[model samples]
Target chain A: MRLALLAAAFCALAVPALAQTSRPEPGPLTIAKQGSFFIGGREVKSDTLSTLPNFDAAGTITVDQMYVRYQAPAGQTGVPITLIHGCCLTGKTWETTPDGRMGWDEYFLRQGHPVYVIDQVWRGRSATDPSTINAVRTGKKPVDQLPTVFSAGHEGAWAIFRFGHQYPQVLPGMRFPLAAQAEFWKQMVADSAANLPTPNPTVPALSELAQKIGGTVLMSHSQSGIYPFQTAALSTQGVAGIISIEPAACPDPTADLGPYKAVPILVLFGDYVDEFPRWAPRLKSCRAFAAAVSAAGGKAEVLALPEIGIKGNSHMLMQDDNSLYIADILLRWIGKNVTATR
Target chain B: MRLALLAAAFCALAVPALAQTSRPEPGPLTIAKQGSFFIGGREVKSDTLSTLPNFDAAGTITVDQMYVRYQAPAGQTGVPITLIHGCCLTGKTWETTPDGRMGWDEYFLRQGHPVYVIDQVWRGRSATDPSTINAVRTGKKPVDQLPTVFSAGHEGAWAIFRFGHQYPQVLPGMRFPLAAQAEFWKQMVADSAANLPTPNPTVPALSELAQKIGGTVLMSHSQSGIYPFQTAALSTQGVAGIISIEPAACPDPTADLGPYKAVPILVLFGDYVDEFPRWAPRLKSCRAFAAAVSAAGGKAEVLALPEIGIKGNSHMLMQDDNSLYIADILLRWIGKNVTATR
Candidate 1:
């Protein structure tokens, strides 16, 4: 209904006199290949019983598990795009909005880009042994004894995502689709807590996936931001471009970023960024990192939407009313920057 | 372009065979009466100083000054709607969006509601002598030397308004029109700090204004929320109804709400209310107050947008993309409740 209103308003303004013409139907999406892979593994043994073999054969554990949902048209763009969701969310982030709207996965697919939405190790379809991994890392058994993870409650998300100044008290000019929050929260899942903070274990797995899929554009959100940069640095040939949205942290400012010199990196920020105490400093860090990347001869650009007439966007611009608008900006950036690298 | 595409999509879905029809332009707004008025005042004198005759014959210091901009169509609703802006913002909150879109002021006017936008004492065009007020109230000189107030910078607003999770990091599902931040920030003015927190001085002034405009619906936002409820209680005969949006504080739950028993009240909550630390408890307090009103035989209703499927709104819902949708809801509530009280 809202879309219809927007459309009616637009039509009323744009072509008041012109008669409507037949609209084109979007082509169907085809599944090129959809599957899972176990990329990284290491030997694990009990601290008290070192002689005992692990649960699986070869006395090893493959903790870095990834599940991919691949979709594209018959004559899709040669360059493929890989999407990684932020913490507490899975690949469903790219599939549908919390309010029942189409997500970027379909948008990108319709735009002719082969899309791969993935669930990182221990999330969504990916499986993991948290007890064994936690025990191996800490040399002790789990303390909570709860195997499953927890979702960030709907109320809790209000603050974490900056949806409003305060819960039950929305600020002026907010654009988050209020009706869709229930569905969006429902998509959240419980994953291994340890894996979310430092996704080092999944770095090699992501890098390997990129290599397996050939040259691809890596788009990472929130906690997943570090993975693309690490993946690009590790397997420079596999990453054609990188788009990180309000990434938690940036690459070491002074560290060698030679591998990233050929890849184009774009970091996008939504409106009202300085309200969070952490984001201001984090953005500075990101700027410094981007400067360092540029200084190291990489093509890196940081975009603050407010500076460019985009206002009142939350950190979750992907699911915003103007998500397609921002997505188009990213798509244009990719068109200009990724073509050469590919 | 986005709207056009949306319209095309809707046309395709709704009326595939029918040709487009011309949309009628909205009619112009008719001004009924627009002016300013000074309400409450008291005389002042310095201690141990030689007495000098004050400028006014009444030895007046009108601390609570108010400027009103009233508009209505040729045939308008008899029940007038009085608008009070939050802290820092003036009556312009109803005029236009930070991004140049039409505000609820015009929308409400078109909806046939006689609208009255007010600049509260010491805000907008309503001027006051802060030093005099401070001296009269505190018996000392003004402490802070800052001449004008400063608004939250664009970056600060993101977190302050919960537009994003962090500063410069918009979360997913935000709908704030990103292009208008600069203009919006530019409109924020430095208001009298003394008046914003409590706005105690303006209570009588607002009450007086309500009396002059008989049986008015007092609509207040943010900082102005408390005033409407207080004024409604003070001038029971003048206030027919009250609508508070994301109000900071609620009336004391334990207080005798006899005056309000005759007036209908609606407290509307925008998206992400639980995000701010104060909101959860604040909402509880508002609920308690509403419940107290109900228990005391008054008409009161509390609305949470999420509960009704409206999601992802920020603190500022009036300037939001779907401000009209929320406005219509308020109008409907007013239509049903205000009529009875009137």
Candidate 2:
């Protein structure tokens, strides 16, 4: 009889705890200072006011600038971290998650690190000029000359983000808050990378930002996975460390690995990569790149969450239900590897 | 000796309170749900993949979609509020201020109103096709045919945002956080309004959003001040109330005021308008529009902050130092004027 009663009590306690959808109330946030700025854009002149609809046009315009927002905790002890988002998303990926949980930005801030979140050049708050499109519509430019912009369809993103093999299908044990799937779709935006120059303007702009902040740990995800490596290759001035999460690609293994020898690099992967045809190959490439770094006497760690017993993470690991748990792992890695060169 | 000691104690207590730059720690926030979505965009087809730089450009491309992010408090009581930003800004206008104070979106959510913040069509997260620009750059189109895109210069925004009469000049008693001026400039972005159709695609998208949300209040600022009015003019379907904050323009006084007759309207202006050449005329025009609405049996109130003893406000009233104090007045107006139609 006593055993039966205890069993009943255990079920009662465990069921609700496991089923509860709401997150715990976040503690009060007190920051020393928080603000935003634009960096690394050039002036482009236009004199076609007669064809433009608004009177404000037809002058020197700034294009290809990057927008950055930052928050610093009071009496900070940890090194500053700069977060870059993946494709079809902006800096909001690092903000409050789709499910209302505290984002990685605030979590890191609370952990004593300053966080800088950016919208890549020509995306989000980063400026893009629309003159060419306007000219085409007005018949001054040919219809065939339209720039190619990409917006991910639901099915494509479902597979790409590794929520499932297809849309409306949840990968068993996937850590993504599937109930908040609608919110996840909203994070996708139109990306104009096809219109940018080779190497992309964001790479150089990020390098400039690293120098501007003196030195910052560059953390990127998915589409921007290779940016930190590319930035480091260009100039190691302020590239302290690189954290690449579920990147679509990594640096070429055969490329000069000299720049990465001094700066520590972490290539992170979520679960279910093996299930997706595209992500599986990408993961393999990343592992090979990490191995190349190690072979070149560089500090490189390839962390597959499943291998570490932290399983069921989606492409958006930072936004998953157990995001903080994963963040703690990254924090430990940073503490051991990334020294504040500033 | 007793009197002197009391005075010293008062100074010790009051001085720090007055001069302290930091705001009080924000209380713990609990929300029932939060998410985001895109609405109202058309797919543009392009068969000229050979001329395009990337492989993603050959298919149907979605363009001119508006991005909306929302948060609903647990057991909401107040009407939903839709916040639309002005020129060169996105839905970020309603977010946490650059100076780290709690934003109006959270304030209203805490007050039990669900809040929807939107990036106007072709702005921020809203997708804009870059194909035309790409074509022009590749010499497939003429250079003179380039579309006109506008970006606010720091000096011009200073004057237009009412921070000062000119660049690097303060309007004596302006309440904009001058120390954070750099952050304010960062809010500016490259706007492609010149490429959009007349009446702008955002007008219809907002109307659709209103209908989708059932019934909600439409709140706009500066560049977007006229959107709510225009949306209402098209269809009063789900417009519960309209709040216009220092808009650049208002509906023509002679235009049909019939649509506004059944809806409540609040046209609000910040201080220092009469001192600026550009703003003085705009304020006068708004007052005339409000008077016309009242004359035509519509409920419209034109409020100049200075007239109500609230002084030193800049154009960005929602981001000023005493933004909460101003928000209180808005809340009072909303309480008395807006009735939840749903």
Candidate 3:
């Protein structure tokens, strides 16, 4: 009788455990003080691919573009991922070795979604903006790290940026001048809109390609995460959903994320952030975004991670348990939420 | 002879211990994923600084920022962190049970660097654009109980964003009209440039605030660790260094991160990260960002996290010794790096 009672008690305890969310309850969401690190760069030893591009020509366009290849699942028509590279790296940063897995794309392919990786124009293996690069010759700044219209605490740097924005046409810092920059940007935007690479038919970034391929899911990490908002706002087609790694917060809450109204966004921040904004607070931005989306009657899921140390945790979740969690969320959503049945 | 041998062994151990980072080494940076939450209706709960600026009026501006504040050594400067939130969460998400103090931020503050919290736009109490909000009222999909952009996904909703460009006149909502959105956005873009808020010398995100308030050093648990990248990237004056708790990764390496770069990024991914990016993927983004930045000539440090279910393995690290370990890292970073004394 005593042994039976003990067994019964254990069984009861186990039953309760089965109904739990598996992890401890998380705290509320707040602003975060974090720096932004996006994209990956290839391990290029020599300066061969490092040669800078110029934007100094009167009408020539100096555009920087990144390209990547992501393999898709053979048969499943699922969500597609279009990755954009951030500042200093190429798409290679998202790749890692864990449990002997080959790459993120391969892992995702096995689980379902097709991967479409894109190298943002400028930093990694992509084309560089020559005019900005050659700005060093103008002696304005030692290097051309600052982008046009960027504001910083540095007075001289700010002034230079302001001046450049106003008269970029006349600035002499490129193989192709302001005209080239503008034209290149226009073309890039058009290209992104018109033809998203079809790594697989499900690659949503390529609407036509994805439609032909079927059931595309959209995913981004770091700097590339920003593209989803841009693409969703600009594109004519509908995407399956959005998955973002660590994306940079736009200084203007109302400004940056204004386009994605009903888009399901999944944001996962690091437990211990390294940097905070010089102008505002992190929680402020986070809350503002969440509130804004909810106020618009949209769904926004936030996961404040404690700590799982995947190197690509900030960019790609393929190796991190967080990614699996997100993937599960997607699976659940697709199974029960979206109108498009898998 | 036995006593001498024992003493010799002790000395050998002591020598290596004394030769450590010269300060404290925060707990390892790892990828961890736990719990799920949403950033909904939190906007109605914010402390408003100004009146609701018209989302449609010309010359309107809406800004959302993320930063942090933590308890650090009285004189510490650049601390470390782990951003712990989803795309829709803010530093506040780190707030739970034992109150904000028991929260990750407080835990780190007790250790050294005041936790830098972030509230990303589209989540938490941050602002949102009205035009993007209009997507919820679409004729194609079902509304009500609608997930915010952060929680949901779709290309049509996200298509409105332009990189580095913003519409300050936009408000948050799904009720705004389409034609009105275009006019509103156009007017907003044109008018926004006129009355841009003048930069303030008194405030600089959180670090400067902490510096003025007198503080130094930092540490974090999860997503909060990733915030440093943003803080560092946007800061007029960069941080000395950072010590991460369980650091997150950037986003997809295939995306663009060249715009934001961190010189020295440290990571500590726990074994738990294996299922992270799969679950949250955003964690992977944080890791990828670190890789990209490290590739850009910065220091990228990653470590393994302690196992869970261990006696002292609280995620917040307040009850655990992890916060103290984080404090150690901040001490070392401040003692060695950060040439300019705050």
Stretches of candidate 3 exceeding 4 Å from the true structure:
A1-62, A98-102, A131-215, A250-259, A273-284, A306-342, B1-342
Sort candidate 3 into its docking category: incorrect
* Model 2: DockQ score: 0.15
Model 2 agreement with the true structure over B1-342: per-residue lDDT tens digits: 523532442322223213323446665455565556677777566542224232344444566778877777777889999999998887767777767577788778878899998888878877665555555656676755555665665656677788887668888777778886655555666677766876788889889999999889999998788989889988999999999999889899999898888789988888899988878988899889888998888888777776655678899989888787777667777887898777
What are the iRMS values of all candidates? 29.1, 5.7, 21.6
Model 3 per-residue lDDT tens digits across residues B41-129: 11121111111221111122223222222223333333444333432123433432211113354444444443444343322222232
For candidate 1, write residues A187-273 as lDDT tens digits. 444334443435456677778777777778999987788789888777787788899998977788887788767788988777777
Query: What is the Cα-based lDDT of residue A121 in candidate 3?
Result: 37
Winning candidate number (lDDT): 2
lDDT of 2 by residue, A1-342 (tens): 523532442332223213333446665555566555677777665543234343434444567778887778776889899999998888879877777687888789889898999899888877766555555656666755566665665555677788888667888888888887666665666777877886788899899999988888999999899999999999998998999998889999999999988799998898988877888999899889888998889988777776645568899999988887778778877887898778
Evaluating just chain A, the predictions reach TM-scores of: 0.80, 0.91, 0.51
Which residue pairs in candidate 2 have backbone atoms (N, alpha carbon, C) closer than 3 angstroms, thus clashing?
A131-B147, A132-B147, A146-B131, A147-B131, A147-B132
What DockQ would you assign to candidate 1? 0.01
lDDT of each prediction vs. the true structure?
0.61, 0.76, 0.34
Model 3 accuracy (lDDT, Cα): 0.34
TM-score of the candidate numbered 2? 0.71
